[model samples]
Target: MAVEGGMKCVKYVLFCFNFISLFCGLALIAVGVVVQVSMHKTFRIMDVNASAGPIILIVVGLLTFFVAFFGCCGAWKENHCMVATFSFFLSLVVIAEIVAVVLGYIYRDKVKTMIDNNLSDMITNYKVGSAELRETLDKLQETWKCCGAQNSSDWKDYGSDGQSVPDSCCLEVKPGCGNGTMTDTAKVHQRGCSDVMSIFLKRDAQWVIIAAIVVAVLQLLGIVFACLLMRAIRGGYEVM
Candidate 1:
């Protein structure tokens, strides 16, 4: 009886919701991988825990994927046990997603602060830093097309030849191109990499937050539908 009438509609909705959730899980995993790569590329010069945020997202995404599989099977089979289990697991996924979002937000702020405080050191370390570190900074500047920690002048103290910027900061690249051009706006990038990259970092973080929040909100409907379907099945309604 419970599966008849509107209960039938509820059952189908539950199935559709889980279908969407399967894709949602895949999306979360993809986003996490992208963000993880960006974090390492952008903040590798600093001491940020670049893996933690993305790892959390990926784990939750895997959980969501498997739970949605349970949901789809249960809803289709009219099985009470699987439906109940699906609801419980979906509830946990929602919570885990929220937590992942909060952690991402916190990590974003911490990275921003770390960049501000450590940019000087990063610039100073260019000559002394390991090959990997120098390459990362060079790529950072070249990709962002920005100069020093704060501006071109920030390189005035760099290397033995003070008042020179890296060739990576040149408006037009050539050997020793940044020599004696610390504040030369026409020759080297004038903006700071910290300021330039921060904009992109913030934008990425916002997308991650929005994605997680949207998925969490949407899954609530699935949870409710699963519960109703479970109820219908447990009542011995013989849901078709």
Candidate 2:
């Protein structure tokens, strides 16, 4: 049994969408790996709490990749069983993402606390940490234009070269630029990294939410189309 006319078009569109989803899954996996590796290389190798986000991304991506492939195969072959299975699995995936978003919103404060504590630990260990850690800290400070975990004053007794703030925190970003500049707001950034990250997330979070919504909508459409195709197949209507 197969579908005719519009059902045929729906079949091809579903296939195309699943093809696109496969690439999206690969992209998510790549991004997750990058984030996880970055976490490992910085902030004293993030604890399990900090590692959960990336691991979830990786798991979701892997599941998406396989399920989308299943969807594509079912659509192309017009197989009732495969199409039904794809629809069920895709629904589960969409539900899981929605749950993740809701949980993230509810636990946002805890996330902020974890980031703050990790950054503070890094600052506390900077004086005795390895060269790689120091370099990573310098890169972070330079990139964010932030002074310390909570502000420049947080470095009252700590620095790289017997100074109050590291040279990376200086406006000029040159050696000795931070010397005698802890009190000079013009010379060093007064804002803390934690605050900077918070500001950044507050400003950019809407974009992430928007993207998630769009993805969820697209997946829902795919699930709906797959179910329709399954129904047509079961009813012995030609969809090819």
Candidate 3:
């Protein structure tokens, strides 16, 4: 009689597990699909480095869907064999999730390192270019200090051919100089550059955070469902 009573409880737990798993799995799949769609362009054009997390989420979502389906079907059938099989599968999935979480953490560190490296390079280049500009400005200041009072007489002696001037001398060009290094320099200093980079970096960080949270939640659910399914299997065996 006690065995029968326990079997009834196990059956109930299995049913609850199946229902919860189904809902969670479908929700995760939906979230993955949404994230994938929204981040497609960013991964394709702006930042390839951050793309892996979403893709992993998609795979996990699909796997969860199937796992939940199998669990639900096995529970509904009240078949000990089927329940045992899926329970084993769920255990394996939990292991895989653990491994994936570890890898995701490692990859997160790598992403941070890559971002740091890129930022360092940008700062280095910007400083070098700025120093060059500063040097030119300083030279022009010195020249003006010595030549200002003398006016055009001093200018005439120096000749208009800028070639005669030191490379450190500043020349005023037509407003629209041919787009060359000057344009590249402008791009580095553009207000938009920092904002764009910040947005992209933030996106990457967001994806990482999402992946971590999703994995944690799924792992917890998997463990709970697996235990429920195991109990159901034991109950079915008792019924036999």
lDDT of 2 at 73: 96
Worst 10 residues of 3 by lDDT: 146-155
Q: Write the per-residue lDDT of candidate 2 for residues 1-240, one digit (tens) a residue.
A: 544488988899999999999999999899889978876544343344556667888899998998899999999998988888889899999999888777766765664576688777778888898887788778888888888888888787785544478898898898878887886988999888888776665455556657777899999999889988887888888765
Rank the models by TM-score, top first: 1, 2, 3
What Cα-based lDDT does every candidate model obtain?
0.81, 0.81, 0.50
Task: Give the TM-score of each candidate.
Answer: 0.89, 0.85, 0.53
Model 2 is weakest, by summed lDDT over 10 consecutive residues, at 40-49
lDDT of 2 at 228: 82
Writing each residue's lDDT as its tens digit, candidate 1 over 1-240 gives 434578889988989988888997898799888878876767564546645667777887788899999999999998888888999988987887788788777777666666766777877777888888778788888888988777888887775678788898998878898998877778999998878877776897898689768877888988888888887787788776
Answer with 2 or 3, whichever has the higher TM-score. 2
Off by over 4 Å in 3: 45-49, 116-240
Clashing pairs in 1: none
The C-alpha local distance difference test score for the whole of candidate 1 amounts to: 0.81
Give the per-residue lDDT of model 3 (tens digit) for 1-240: 135566556556665766676676777778778887775543432345556656766677677667667777766776656666666766776777667656755665455455444433332343355664434332432333211111212122222442122222223323333123221332212122223444456576667657656755655665565566566556545432
Model 1 Cα displacement at 120 (Å)?
Answer: 2.8
How well does candidate 3 match the true structure, expressed as C-alpha RMSD?
Answer: 13.7
On TM-score, the leading prediction is 1
